[model samples]
Target: MRDDAPHTSNVPYLPRRSVHLDFHTSPLITPIAQQFDPQEFADRFARLGVDSVTLFAKCHHGQLYYDTDRAERHPGLGGVDLLRSQIDALRPLGIRTPIYISVLFDEHAATTHPEWVCVDEEGGPVRVDSHGVPGWHVLDMTSGYRSYLAEQVTDVLGHFPDADGFFYDICFDQLSSSATARAAAIEAGFDPDSPAGRLDAAAAVSHDYMGRLRDMVAGDGHDGVPRSVFFNSRPRLRLADELGFSTHDEIEALPTGGWGYAYAPSVARSVIPIQPRAIGMTGRFFGSWGDSASIHPAAALQYESLQMVSLGLGICIGDSLPPAGRSHEAVTARLADTFARVQAVQECATGAQRVAEVAVMRAPITGGEGVIHADAPGAGELAALRLLTSRGIDFDFIGPGDDLAGYRAVIVLSGVGIDDGVVRSLTLHVESGGALVLSGLPDDVASLQPLTGLSSADVDGFAREFVRPNAAATGLPDFDFVLPGAVRRVRAEGDVHTLATVTEPYFDRTPDRFSGHEYTPAGAATAYPAIVARERVATAAFGLFEAYGATGVPEIGDLAAATLEAVFPRPALRIDGAAHLEGTLGRRSGSSIVHLLSYLPSRRSSADIETVVDPVPALDVAVRVRLDDRSPRAVRTLEGVELPFSVEDGYVHFTVSFDDGHCLVVVEEE
Candidate 1:
């Protein structure tokens, strides 16, 4: 199948203002439908500008909210067909309703059928505990639970014929240590204890279960039209090829949650290649999901939602209904303010493609097969991203499977082992006049010697070393001491030139040869070249990006940025603004849109929440867009404020005052 093939028939109907309503109720809760007025709820959503909503059919407690024959309804519910009422109320308003089903963390199913629970390595059921509440055990997909899930999904689809789609929650491959799991593993001809065997077994079971769920939904949709299906797993590198347009939940509880502020932007950028049409899912709570009393500020919610749109992603705001089934009026009001801004940009953002000149290629996790072993960003890659973002450089994260010909330059981070596929693609890119800025040389540098213009020699590394720029290094200052993680000595051949040199310390910092504090001072500059550049390829022997990210050394980041500028002198777009001002470019048909976002959040205390104060004062900014041969007919903001612009040397230059937290500049071509 083609990479851009349509995954579902309902792709055109996917909405920007989608809400994921959480209904995970407990058995002790009563009067579940006391305040559940279907008309009022639907009207509230419509007032909030919501075009799509995901209502819960079944929650994690295995409690069915609706009256079902295949599954038991919640004991706390008062015999109300809540799901049918919701679908009926929302269908007439042109609001698409997608049914949500918790597949793995079904408490009732696990308690009734212990054989279906996944067994961990310690021979115990896989259980989760969340925020002082005892969590439910996970169900093994390879067991009879798979069939039960299929039946539950089929029952829902049969009942709600007008449902827009299905959102499968908590669906993952768990490592099973049960007798049945081991038997299946042995039958697959592998040792049950091995990691590869466990991965293969889990992948196979998950794939089969997902396929079954898809088939059931496809067979029972409205009027022979198959609804769209999405699974909830972010950073799904291993299963991207199998999954379609899904929701990526980057549960970033800003300052204090597990995901930091940078997590969403990084993960969202990386995920675009796998699922281009993916939607970003964040919560309205101050902390995380299921936090009933915690509500985020409207400003915070607006920033998060706009961040998603700026990165070419749709937005889904997550909210949880109380046991009384009453929607919070305060929350709805805040959501209204946030969604209004989303509606303003939805027309330009939808179906638009990101315009990036630099593609920062992530190192292959498992050689070239693209099987994910680790999903976290590497030290060097994270550092490069931070540097680029701080300097107002537009870039995107790409994988081995992504096409590199569209980018003007590609930066390969440290420790990326290039396989045959990557070598072929990079070679073709360079031959087409695209520049390459590689941090470290690949293992098989011999194959790429012609492009790199250097031959590998004896590699010399220090526990801590400094980098000093040579006379040829313009726009870079000579550093007295800067940390470059590792260094490999290379002999320049043909027309290669050394840009910088590595300086070694007096002695290696061992317990016996330790200096006064950290390490000995830098002694003499070595003959080994720190950075080398050929005709098109520039290679840095040291792990400059990774070390700078890990250490946050100002010198390291400055040197790295300088070297990047030297490699790609004239980027497609350049922005001159504050460090916190973020800009991204996107193209929709004959026009280009530049999204400028100013991040000005105040840290009141050491708490995890970021409070948004008044908007910062407008900053003087200049944007230069290289149009090649095309000429711009007009340059203006989305609000129709014309900006003064001039064309010089095949580039369109303009200046704007950025004040309103967010602004979009449209460049229409003639």
Candidate 2:
């Protein structure tokens, strides 16, 4: 195990370079693993710099790859223990093999035992594919499928006692209306008829199942070797509640595979704090899993892998094995190049710790109604990340329960529910000299009076309004710009500074009152304030974060950046470059490593394929790092090239040039 490898109590260390091989062979397919030469398989993976490979024990097609009597084996395997053979081959080569098992979406279990199928609210079987489509069906985890899965797991454990670990897939909320689930919900004192109650019941089942599975794997038979455990398909945002179930996080965000370029960074930032020993999973396919023919461009793979390592996390490239069990030449070759790039900067990224200056609340603090819950990142959370990233501002996502003392500013997005606890936290943060930025109107304005220094008034009673930035509003146009969302009117009390004011239109665009072809022009400037700031706290009456996400208006992001600046003027780290050049700062040992990524994805075809063909043009980058009073011993690239530098105002200022997709700069402090 390397020093840079991610580790947990159960799993002491995980390989930095791993591969997730998906082998979901249908029962009808012929000669599964028949052509699989153990040596060839091992040689290919070892050649590609893979230290760990997740092999399949069972797949969504409901067929086991290994020789098993308790479950239906893949007919194509012809009584071959494919799983065991692969492990036998890889283990001797010093490669760890984590066996994968499908949990909920099992076609065999659902087809043969229809009684175990998950029932949806409409009394129909819950499924991933629509009617007449050929795909796996969802099974009720609280039904007989629970015992069935447990039995299969026991069988696997009994056979391969020395297996490296287990990777559980499709472990998420399988909300059900089945009799068993309904009865369990009732026994747990929840109204199964309600959507919220049903969701809660489902979450409880998932949590319990996860605990049982974890205990079973950790139970006696490991031969003293610690085994890793992970559950895929669970929402990353909600992992805070279920951290006990897994040893590490395998974030599966295939950028070109529908999880866009922004998804990986946003998810990694949120999940890394809780589970630092994590790996970012991206597929080799340009599209997604099972798209074997259309491979990812070499540039895309390099960008994805470098981005993951840059964040102080390991990288895993996903690939699928053909039924004949031979590795694809093209995929193998491309991966070799990508892995080499990762190895180039492996030393610099080894022990780096990301430095975040601001904490963006994932959900608003609620009084008791509970904060927002979603299977994906909330609009405000994702949008806020994009805004900050574009401006070269570093941040992390935090829940209400997370500590705020380490952060310089806290951003509360729109559409969040507020409670007294939230109000107290914000108030304390502001009073302690920390900054607070509220995106939109909360349910109750009076609750935040201490922070906002304003009282609840009335709505602006207009469909839309224009914002005119005063001199106090820095970096904004003095002229009016369209503010495109609902604005909550508030009366400024005490000593509050108005950064911008609202200008209402002459009249509503009614049938009788016609203006230009579109919205009415700005007519009168009102006393209402669009932005207000009071002693380390600022409020944007409109849902700027949410609006910016929904509509990528340039003015909206500009306003957000300026508002953040007004509250927290001195960020810990600042970078001056093209907006597309994403910067990530981290500390390791006696130095800090700054990762600059400069690859821009392009949609080349009508099918919406995001590909990166060429490296970015030569970019001149300037970085300002706050070292306080300590002087910099040296500033150099990871390749050991010393660069010219200067010090001023307790900060080290340096400049470097990089045209490559990724660049690593190390700053040594004395």
Candidate 3:
């Protein structure tokens, strides 16, 4: 589990990544108006740069996506051999094929082997879906579902030896097995009087079931590769690691809203590195009334996915398959284009140059937008975290009076905004080889002046606006490149842009609401930072790119890349994210690539659409493009492009021009 060597595990999510898609036809899928052509669909995937596709299946339909050593056929739909053509067609495209098997629901298995069905205390069978509606039915993880699943997957994999891999969707073992059994036991008086006792017992049972399933599939590497397990929304991804499983999935919101986008940044930050080599990451942007990351370039998708990759996480892009049929031409074309860009990210990034050893663990709270407020970041962000587990970064949501020591960095996201102590802790951390990146209203910077040996006599903090980090000004490198354009200027020393102002919204301002506070941002800080970091380094350190990134030239010149490369050429962990889509970027052993989800632009299309998003987007993001920098250039985004930029004092100010109601600007050091 050390960074010096490869961490051995059963799950592997790299090179040939898998995705989930819908089915056109299935033997037991009842009757429907839409029928998708397997060949056409397979060919379509090949064109879209997809390596694998899956079916949201319940029964082992006779169309035979999986071979049956068991029962027989259902005329017309029997032995269609859909996997064969897909395997054959995908080969030339360099795509590996993988199939997804729904573990919990199988109308066939339920009917054929009724005993396998979990029975309630009332002696009734568990029901997951009643009248075709999605609902939870706690199943028995300790039962025959293990062998049945193994047999089903094994049979499917055996049928198509050419299949690239298998992605297990709806991990029934975790929730169905653990949570249900615990809830049921509590109700049945299995220590129901004690909540802690009930939870402990349930977890023990859940852990046992998952461990068994993992042991059954411990990487013989047959049928392309073993099954890739996605433990849905569970923070304890280590459960998968302990079970010899690798890979995890999460739904994140678009940045501008930032690392706090939907989910807590610390939550994603906490688990990303534990097993990043083949770690799985995913998210839903949600609430994109209409906007793209680029000029109709699936902006949201590109933004979120890229950020994840830079953070050293693999991506499993997710989206709902059309309710009617196979993908529409527009959907397919955009996907192809989006994935191609991801490939480019993989190409441009290499070595440890973009991957930094996560010396700190910082995860702020989620929900409630605006300046510092206690309840803004949720309780989920406050869990205890083990940063040392991930070879790189480690983060946990900060709680009231939480002791933060023994870390080189302490990251605070959009949780409670710029708290005086949080600022002091980061300053102390930086003073001791630590670094910090506080995304969103970073008014706490003013609090650091006292610790950094600076006078904060004229500091006036606001949220919104922007400011840039400086290696020379602050003697910090990690934060050098993350500059804010229109900061609130919370503090001021003569003409210098000190800590910026960020107002805590009335919604985010419930000091006493910490207990009953359903975090709601009701006020606003003067200016909020989209991205912020606290950096430290000696002035003798040359070729420092962070401070020089805004200069549009390598700080140490080309020599930085050649002479004393390790020293001059600083290595970093690039947490890449774009708006629109969700995914991850990670490096294990030296090979680094950006795995991504295809960005879904607004269903409505228009030209030159632009909008202003209050909070800066979260997740790590890097935009690759050629900017016409005759002035401070507003770099182009999937939402749209801007041609002008501004430079004033030590700040770089600019507005993003996009038709989709979003704007972004960077204020890197010059």
Candidate 4:
């Protein structure tokens, strides 16, 4: 994280480090793991703008990807030094590679020397039937297994200092049956026949055992890279550090109806004022909501998600590797490509000149739309914010009014619970000539009542997701209107410009922890409308709008693409449809690389579908850039080279294309 650039007020914009791949992922595509092809991989990422990767899976395991004396070949598996070749190839691509070590999952060593494994609840060793393996013993970690683990971790790290750091996975099961059973074993005096007492020893062994190993990792002489633990629930921050860990990651991979990658930037960022270390969000079990869809790698949501993390929101994107230790080559390629873009962003951000002269925007509610919806208890706002950010729209920040004059627009989220003062400030933003938009008011009024022109009153229902392509909109027929009276006519553009409208209102419960109110059954919806506009460049970005993310395509109060750009007028980037893929920004040679990734064989799985048995068959990408801001530029495609630009509304547009499952394109000023 070192840089030669002098710090500035904008230094907060500096990029932070990120490693998307985690060790515990379940790869449906059979992750591409072969005779490590470093050069080819490096070249792939070089195009993407990434240069660092945290080798989480087989990188640090005692078992080798291929046969090697340095480690044991996992039982019934061939070996491959995927890490070594990847790292070696990456060096030339100017990428940093790191490995994750699960000192806990050394099946070979742990099972062979059960003494080194963790004990059960009572103080005796934990015993698992190994799923179907009837006699395989669960290694006991509590009973003096420190040396064994340290050696394993150190050895793995020692092999690759060039790696960014270590991503520790599933080592501490603070809330697993294993811990419960171990506790019982301890009370039973390690008595196997003690009925319920069968786990006390195992629990104590696990708890104390992990603690000791943690100390050794910190105190041990041979220091590997800084370590980060996965979804560690051991509450105290100091405790995590004492155990040789620097990062306590957010939860990753839990079923949220299948939203791929289990982290929400909006929720995470909203909590930053309270806890800074809650920087990362990790979700392993992803469940798709009937409404939400996969991310488009070329879209702003991707950028916003990363930016939210960059702006003090650490991110943890996790996936499970195949049991066979293989990763889908296509998936890996997409990862590498996006990693490059993210790396570039981070590099540019961290090493930039900071100048503290800009304005910020608050999420806006135009016309009849008012305060935004309250956050659901478990669903954080970080993801929502990221969705906005990924669109490249700069949002209004929360701070002193001194910065207000610096901003051109002030959006108001008119929800049932908005404090009165905000309503007053919003009244002023509109009166001052700023553009606005709204969602989920009433259809009774033919025109927008307040907020900004970002909305319209004709009240067509919400529009279909652009990714799916819908020319018509289907929104809430009508709803109760909650006008605070503080808002009035912000502007009258005539037919020349119509009031814009966001999609339908969404309902959700606030995170059980952050709110003071009792949970209510009615639930809260994004009652507010969205607004958008361009602000001063250095001081702030143009385009600000409130959005109730896709609870379902074209919701009653959700934001729409056409309306979004209408109110904002200016945007960092624009897209045509909803995406079948996800993307991110990266760097390979310390430059910006924008990644657009989609799993190959993209057979549509409605967010409701669970397991990913196959990937999308075709996930190509095509972005039109403003290269030189004038002349037309050509991007290559399977169809053939095509012009990606045309003079439209006084701006030059160029296309950068990626196609069929996975693709990427980098844009550097010519």
Candidate 2 residue lDDT tens string, 1-670: 2335444444444668889999887888887777899989888877877778999998998888887786578877876789989998888776788889999978889889999999977898887753237566889988999999998889889888887789999887778999999999999888899988988898889888888888888742233457888988886656777888888898888887767787788888888778887999998987877788788988888888888888777899999998999888998999988987787688666667788888888563221211113334556776787777655567878776678888889998876568778777888888788999998868688888888887877665588778777755566677777766546788898888888878888877887886998789988888888888887888988886776777677776777778888888777577777767777788877888888888889899997668777668536688888888678899999788998999989879988897778778888999
For candidate 1, what is the lDDT? Answer: 0.74
lDDT of candidate 2 at residue 36, scale 0 to 100 = 91
Least well predicted 10-residue stretch by lDDT in candidate 3: 383-392
The lDDT of each candidate is 0.74, 0.80, 0.38, 0.37
The candidate maximizing lDDT is 2
TM-score against native, each model: 0.91, 0.92, 0.52, 0.42
Number of clashing pairs, model 3? 117
Residue-by-residue lDDT tens digits, candidate 4, 461-569: 2222111112242233332222111121122332333222222323223464322353222223322233223221000011212223323233312334344444554
After aligning candidate 2 to the native by TM-score, how far in Å is the CA of 487 from where it should be?
2.6
- TM-score of candidate 3 versus the correct structure, residues matched by position: 0.52
Off by over 4 Å in 4: 1-34, 56-71, 75-82, 103-148, 157-164, 175-244, 247-262, 270-670
Write model 1 residue lDDT over 342-379, tens digit each, in one string.
88886655556777678888766541221122355667
Candidate 4 lDDT score at position 65: 43
By summed lDDT, the worst window of 10 consecutive residues in model 2 runs over 365-374
Clashes of each: 2, 1, 117, 197
